[model samples]
Target: MTIREITDLVQGEVLCGEERAGDEVACVFASDLMSDVLTLKDVDNLMLLTGLCNLQSVRTCEMSDINYMLVVRGKEVTEDMLELAEDNDMVIVRTKYSMFKTSGILYAAGLPPVY
Candidate 1:
């Protein structure tokens, strides 16, 4: 689904990369553990759904080449994280919903699991 549609589905706000809201993602990998993200191989067209809202999360995404991130649980995104994300041309989205609900909403919306 498109990032715009994903935002609408999860009631999320685009914290940055609003210009790329038209980008489409075919799959997602949800986790709070950066290590889990580090384990991925093919990162193309994948979006991350995570409760971890720190710089480490964006860093991990940069390392893994995962370009879209949905920060769940209403966790705050720091300026450092946003700066890093912007530097890497990443999309940062935030939602008040829990990880479970956000994952379900995106999955049902046709963004497949990256498992």
Candidate 2:
């Protein structure tokens, strides 16, 4: 799915990388654990959905080559986090839905899980 489609499906607000809205995502990885995120390698076009609103999460995304991140449960995204994501050219989307609900919506919309 495209980032634009995912944003609409999750009712998300783009916090950064608006130019990347047309990027295609191959799958979704929803987790708040940075360790779990670290285990993923060389998996291209991944979109991360997490409730962890921190710089580490942004760092994790950069290292994991995740182009898009959808923050769930209406968490507050700090300016530092936004700046870091922008530096990495990662697209960040904020959604009002819970992690589970956000995942479900994406799944129902044909976004496969990383598994």
lDDT leader: 1
Give one digit per residue, the lDDT tens place, for model 2 in 1-115. 8899888887888889999999999998989999999998756999898999998999988888787899998899999999999999999999999998998888998889878
Clashes of each: 0, 0
- The C-alpha stretches of model 2 lying farther than 4 A from their native spots are none
lDDT of 1 by residue, 16-114 (tens): 999999999889999999999999998898999999988899999999999999999899899999999999999999999999999888877777887
Which pairs in model 2 have colliding backbones? none
Task: Assess each prediction's global lDDT (C-alpha) against the native.
Answer: 0.93, 0.90
* All-Cα superposition RMSD per candidate: 0.6, 0.9
Q: Which ten residues in a row have the lowest lDDT in candidate 1?
A: 106-115
Per-model TM against the reference: 0.98, 0.96
